[model samples]
Target: MSTLAAMIAADYGTIGDILRERARETPERLAVVMETGEAVTYAQFDALADRVAAALQRDGIQPGEAVAVCALSSIPYAALFLGALRAGVAVAPIAPSSTPGAIAGMVADCGARLFFLDAGVAEAQKPAPVPARQIALDGSAVGEAFDAWLAPEGATPAPVEIGPKHPFNIIYSSGTTGTPKGIVQSHGMRWKHIFVGDTIGYAHAPVSLLSTPLYSNTTLVCFFPTLAGGGTVVLMKKFDVVRYLELAQTHRVTHTMLVPVQYRRLMEHPDFDRYDLSSTRMKFCTSAPFSAELKGEVLRRWRGGLVEYFGMTEGGGTCILMAHEHPDKLHTVGRPAPGHDIRLIDEDGREVGPGVVGEIVGRSASMMNGYHGRADKTAEATWTSPEGLSFIRTGDVGRFDEDGFLTLMDRKKDMIISGGFNIYPSDLEAVLATHPAVVEAAVVGVPSDAWGETPVAFVAARGQADPEAIRAFVNDKVGKTQRLAEVRFVDALPRSHIGKVLKRELRETWQKSPTT
Candidate 1:
């Protein structure tokens, strides 16, 4: 078996070193697989990644250029990721199922220079007016059928030094108040996260099944942490409640990162009893806090094993519920990860003692270098401390108990987290505002019996706008989670001049409205 070149070593200067090292040592090891049973081993993955880099270089893809992967989660998607990073391309994977308008907006916002997409999307993508080197994934992307171009036909990418300070990727956050901002993450930022797939649970656990979208930060923060230590990553192309349980029993999967909604679905799935989750050693739930009763149900179903981790895309983890911790504390996100100093501070940044819920502020290497091109937002989020720790102001509201475990209370942003998905009311508002009949729009998370918090839109229209029409517009335009459960028109939208729609006011008005 051809292993990754042992001669190549990490000098701590480049970001691609991670995959290179893995490829060098265990080229035959499975790096990633798809539901169709296609697999990419380290050597093959590396070679394919090399092809992607070569293709980019053929057109003079300079280091530090932004390359966006518009393909779905597949072997090609993985190649584009590692290949781009190795070539010093800032990676951002756009959802292929998304609408062309949203995709175009994302491309324009990120300034993507190259696009790797499927033939079905190529024509639709070209009209987006993006200046990019576009390529079709079908004929050229690496897979089992294989592309001959994956073999070196030209000079291979010369290893470049990626530093702790260099930006590795830029993932967009749905701006609840305005246009979505790209959060730029650095290689140093990712390496500094103390907990993830590899961190030892009180007792060692193995065999993790990943159901989170590979592009989401949860995958990077939870799964990559394990891959860093050479842990196996079992992929599920998409979540299927039946298959999820079967895989657990079949593989004896010990670890997984579950969203609260997925957890609820698993808990409610009829097939859960047909298989054995008894082998599940540790389960970490995030995106939103799991209820105490739900935690108990999860522990009871999985046999007393459930924990939680609190984190965001813009910063490192706030806390983790370790296996060693209390069951009563299951609802709490345990103390901050090492190297992160977490605190609950009020509006002025004054530290609030235990039990006072406030926006969580944390400092760590896992924090973003900055929100890409949004300097004003970046300065507000990041603060340089005299002690040398760069503190990240996490926008969520939570507090530490006397035991040091964190209790999540309310969120400060109108960010609707449904099924572990963040749906920005403002992003939807912006999309809806473009409608000719729409005079104003406000989105809020109404109490959902199923999805924890489902987004509902309240609109004021000048002429006429069908709720179903608006929902269809957004449903086709965004990720599945961003879909509105329902839409209702109001007489007027409450706004605070500067003409900003006061989301909090709208939320309260919706909560009390008879039409609600």
Candidate 2:
């Protein structure tokens, strides 16, 4: 076998093992750096992780148990995550933006015996009852400070056998009212992600800046691999366009991941052209809709390869758009990634032909094991092929072009139905986006007495544009079935933590309006 094949097939042991190897190979190299001006070398980070693992074992954290971290991004958070994996424990990194009730409920649902929180999160959630012992990531008067909770510096935990089937982490899905669904990703899945850069020229000492929250899977795609590849990762507690640019220039950052909204903010920054980003090698965007215009703008101004990834936290299939290489396919999400079997199925569950819109379903080696403790929900999220292959259902409506590139047409739940005709909100949104005054546009279905449901548009504009005129302009461009029933102007669209427009909030606001 070739050297590359041997590396791919070799057992990487565990995340802990990888860190140990890097520490041994490059002890003095920086492993992690935070915006707070604190940095840790590979040897220091590995030792801290070992101390964390030893501490967990000393506290009776058994193998396969869940350890929940509901805190802001910090070096301790990173150490805890890797340490949990070293102890054969699965880490559940809950979103800090989540409400107190939601956080408490998720902690209970995950059955985590140990909970870690930041000072702010601990204070906000003090009213809510927590079952587990709480440790504070930041030095706070919470349950215990992270420093106090660590084992002795030289202590080592008992080794536990780890296999591919072992759960590495459980990423809870966002936008849940009650307990969110925990997507259980196996060690093998993460291992695949770690080595994805082997053939992509990531072996070089790349510096990655993680502006998105660590709790998000969007950040992990680039964060984890950079570490496993012995690269430096700069962690930003919160994203600021000016600070990001300064850091990128100072560190000569080569790789980073940002959501679409961040890209928009960076591009629109007053001093966008003032920074030197020539050292950037690869930039990735995911977690929300990225308009072709925005992609084109980034490609023109940014000094690196821009790739867009379309997939879910469930990890069924991934579509990668190398915008630099395929400029013509900027509007599409590119073709299915290698080893990913993607298919579009109609409402009746029959496979659709090219150019026919359908719901995307796919099977891949990296697919999630299942939603933790929710078999029925897991089954509902899965689909079986005619040939008995299991696939995860992505509730996205899209079509494949002649070149096998996928063009998304709004989400299935967001599809507007008027006069018994299906209307994709993306089509209408695209028209609204073309308006010179519009900065961002979103379309949501609202109840209508005459058509059962009708399309309504919400836009953030650059100037005081008349909503009625904008609505009429969009209506003239779209078909009669897809015309907007109403248009409203807002300073900004309500977005999730990861930049997804919350159309449901728009629908609720519209329904509550007296004029409606």
Candidate 3:
């Protein structure tokens, strides 16, 4: 067996160790390339990681301690993340787009001893005091500069043993109010993902392009696997349609992970067809609901295997829908992955038979440990089965077909009860997507004295689509109970960084101005 293959086949391994091996095997190979033209060799990346680890250790950071980073994707940030892992420390990657208070709360909640950020985040978060000592990822005056903070280049960190159950990262969910819950993923969970990557296509040293922020698990799923497989990583600090196309063509990127909205925007861009993306071997989408129409479009126009992963950052069960493999099952999110037991349960926690709509819950080897420091919240998210197995409650309502394909309805909390019928927002959104002029749409439950609760549509339209006309088109197609009571035109839907339409914000807008 090849040395790399043997290393990957080991019963257990940490990402840091695998990276060190890659550096040993292919020192001269490109490890990372930034959009701004900076690049690093595998050897250089490994050395930098060593220095980072050594520095963390020298500063009295212990194993199992955490560090916080809020910065745009860059080589230094990536190196620091890897370095922390080497020192057996967990990383809390805060979103730079978060409110200053949220950023400060996350740093404190994660119990980080050091916080690293760039100039932009430093300036924006000046109003909120970060609990940890700050270091600047960029050479700005806000904190100690990264270059100066590094342990000398030749320094090696004291060896530390990393176990499977140790926290790999604490990913904070985007909460609308209060502090977001931190989902603690383990090294074991990440190993499972890395193994899956090898089985799929990451073993080929393919050039992977990532446009999403480093703080997102959506980005790391692709990021970690590419590095583990010794592939070159191409990062975009921010996504731009033209720039994305240019990079894809220039880098001949073979792998990528994009959210559904990104796919929609790229496919709709006028210059999309101009780029040559034949080198792409696999494309992944997750974090938000992926429309069947968009999946079909990607399959038709994009080269590579278009796979949509359905799961949560908490990592309960994952559904992989390979659009290219199952054209007939485009509407469904595919069957449960091997070894992943997915079940649909009624509101009362009773298992439902096939073809019955219920809350989706799943159990797998790749589950998260728990929500960091929130045992009560963690318990709320889990449901124990009759067999005494714990399953993560997806909070998503779906039905499993006889063939085992899972078709999502909507979030259980987002279901609208108009007169007594359960109206799924996705059903309305799907109808709106069929309209020739509707670019994108979101549906939310609005207060209605007549129906108790009513469906309202928020739509982003093309050139000159009338909101009333679009509403009429959608309402005509849906059942009476699912019909929209009002339609509001929007320039674009408010979305989280990972492309999930912020339905709560839409609902708030309707509540604030019901007539509009």
Candidate 4:
């Protein structure tokens, strides 16, 4: 037996250890591949991580210190992410799409000693005063070239004793304008994810195609599992439907994780059926509300298991709806995963029974350590049970069916209360989407003199549809209290990078132009 293989056989607890083992077990297997055709073998991938760790150590980055990277998905970015974990350094992956102020705030918040970014972000974030020394990942003149900054070939990183509580990476909450709070996920949390992947066929050395940005927790849930299982990860810097179909056909990708909007686009594509996706073993969706209609379409047309995960990035409990297995339960996000405890509590923090709409609180083994440097915020987000077990409050309002399936109503903050009547925006949005002339819709509560608050809808129409006519149609279908007071036409609804509708933006726009 190989020496490295024997070492890994004893125990491969961490991600870096798993990479080392995969290099020894399948040295020539493709570890990562870019949409542009750049690829790396497991052996080379391990070596690159080692170099990154060595360089950070040489620069006096202690095990607990952090580094930040803001760039598009690429080979070097992926390696640097894993390498930092190897050196016991946490990574804060800021989105390049974020405003310059948000980027600067995150870099400062994480206390990053070295900021690694591509030329594009460097150019965009000029004069933002990044506190750390910069290293250019794309060899741009904005900072030192990545290759030149890396430790010399054949260099080795000092061994790091990674513990369960060690910070793996800091994922900032999804927001484009503000400096979102950083969620500090420990190595133990990630290990749970990898283990969960094994149960769902991620251990088969699958070829996974990923289109989501590396900065998202939505991507890492799939990305880390594929790599840990010695599978090849094919990344796209940006998502294009035709390009995605072509890569899936060419690579025979076995697994994928796309947000609901991406799936809707693929299913609605003109030639979606022409692509051969028979090799797919599973397709996962998360990060947004997936409508039952879209899930049905995917199950009918796509050739794989369809699973929708309902949870938060802060790592509370997760509910997995295996769509193929539970066709009748398409409206519900499945039961809480094994060993995960999910509960519902009223506004007063008292536990509510099934069939009652309340805030979703969950507890599990795979929870985040806390919000970085925000103890008050962390405490505010947590709810202590009678047994003193802390649960993460999801801020989502949902109810459990008789069979224990969860049906999400809407975000707690988004629920509209008009004259003491509670109205879920999703309920109104669902009816609006069914209108023949409407492409999509969003409903937000607007100020009202009589009702205190009233429902108003902003819709993206298929073509020239009369706003009054559509509003009348919807009001006729829903109850008087649930009816929309006004309908405004928009070319498109504002969305975050992960495809969540920015309801705050919609509300702000309405407040600015309250002509109606």
Candidate 3 — which residues are off by over 4 angstroms?
none
Question: Compared with the true structure, what per-residue lDDT tens digits does model 3 show for residues 1-516?
Answer: 967778799878899999999999999999999998899999999999999999999999999889999999999999999999999999999899899999999999999989999999988998998988889998888899999999997999999999999999999998853469999999999999888887679999989999999999999999999999899999999999999999999999999999998998899898898789999999999988888888988998988898889998998899998888899898999889988999999989999999899999988989999999999999999999998999999999999888889999999989999898999999999999899998889999988888889999999888887888988898888887888888889999999999988999998888788864
Candidate 4, poorest ten consecutive residues by summed lDDT: 3-12
Candidate 3, overall lDDT?
0.92
- In terms of lDDT, the best-performing candidate is 4
Off by over 4 Å in 1: 1-15, 97-99, 119-129, 138-155, 194-197, 201-206, 303-305, 383-390, 414-516
Compose the digit string of candidate 4's lDDT tens values, residues 197-227: 8767888898999999999999999999999
Worst 10-residue stretch by lDDT in candidate 3? 173-182
Q: Score every model by TM-score.
A: 0.73, 0.97, 0.98, 0.97
Ranking by lDDT: 4, 3, 2, 1
State the lDDT at 57 in candidate 2: 95
Q: What are the clashing pairs of model 1? A: 4-23, 4-24, 13-161, 13-162, 14-161, 14-162
**TM-score top scorer:** 3
Local accuracy by lDDT, each model: 0.67, 0.88, 0.92, 0.92
Q: Give per-residue CA lDDT, model 2, range 254-359, as digits (tens).
A: 9999999999999999899889999988999998989999999999999989999999999898898999999999999888999999999998899999999999
For residues 346-434, what per-residue lDDT tens digits would candidate 1 score against the true structure? Answer: 76767789987677888765778777778898888865445665678777777788888887655577667798776666567667766
Backbone clash pairs for candidate 2 read none
